[model samples]
Target: MQLVLVRHGKAEDPAARPSDLERELTTTGRSTVKAMAKGLRLCVSGKVAIWTSPLPRARQTADILANAFRVKKIREHDAIAAGDLEVLASDWRDLDPQPKALILVGHQPHLGSWAERLTGAVLPIKTAAALAVDLDEDSALSGMLRWYAHPKVLAGLADR
Candidate 1:
């Protein structure tokens, strides 16, 4: 099985949005997510499962990809961290794994931090970027990073 962790697209600054939960994705963020979503569709084959943080920015990002694939609507998961890696992986392992690809849409530090914890390397996954980790067949719990690409890169790829 594969796990895909995605940081939500860029959002209005904390001060600008009326409420943190109601903040929407910026124009740039929507474009970037569209490109990234296209890249994911080209790269992975299977029914995709998507999860998102409770925050509005994440929900907006998920909306950008709503037409790309059949996926679960955004669900709020507290384990998706703001800066804690432990929470990301801890929540990941604890969650039930289906046979298909699982995508967790969430925030920073937690995304990169969790990748570091799992792969022992700091992967700077940007807004709307995704990282795929390969789980071991023996344990089926832990994993190692296979590859990760940033939203910018995916957008570039989509432009080509």
Candidate 2:
């Protein structure tokens, strides 16, 4: 299985909203995410499934990805927001016919922590960052880090 973990793009200052969940991506954030999406689209092939947290920022990021990939629908999964690594892994494994690639869009520490747990490597995923893990049948935790890309790297790819 291939897992692609993505951190939500830069969002409005938390202080700007009473609730953190209400925070939306800034203009720069959207542009950065669009670049990241373009880069990702080049690498991804076949059927892809996208799951995202319900939070505005994550949903916005997912929307960009979905559009880039031309996906008909984006699935919302609570485990993405809850940041339960085990549950998220289990959910992925449980899919009847697993997708060729799974893209999960969510927040910071959660996404970072999930990547660490999966690959046993401390990967610092910045805003609009993405990490791709290649997992054998054994366990999600045993996956290997295939590639990691941030906005800067993706932006360079987008320019070509």
Q: Which predicted model would earn the best TM-score?
A: 2
- Clash count, predicted structure 2: 0
TM per candidate comes to: 0.81, 0.95
Give the range where candidate 1 is weakest over 10 consecutive residues by summed lDDT.
Answer: 81-90
Candidate 1 stretches greater than 4 Å from native? 18-22, 81-97, 138-141
lDDT of 1 by residue, 61-131 (tens): 76666567666465566666355545554555566655367677888777777677666768877788888
Q: Which residue pairs in candidate 2 collide?
A: none
Q: Roughly what TM-score does model 2 have, to 2 decimal places?
A: 0.95
Per-residue lDDT tens digits for candidate 2, residues 1-160, read 7899989899999999999979999999999999989888877778899999999999999999999999989999988898887888888889879999999999878988877777888987899989889987887667898999877887788679
Worst 10 residues of 2 by lDDT: 135-144
Best by lDDT: 2
Candidate lDDT values, in order: 0.72, 0.89
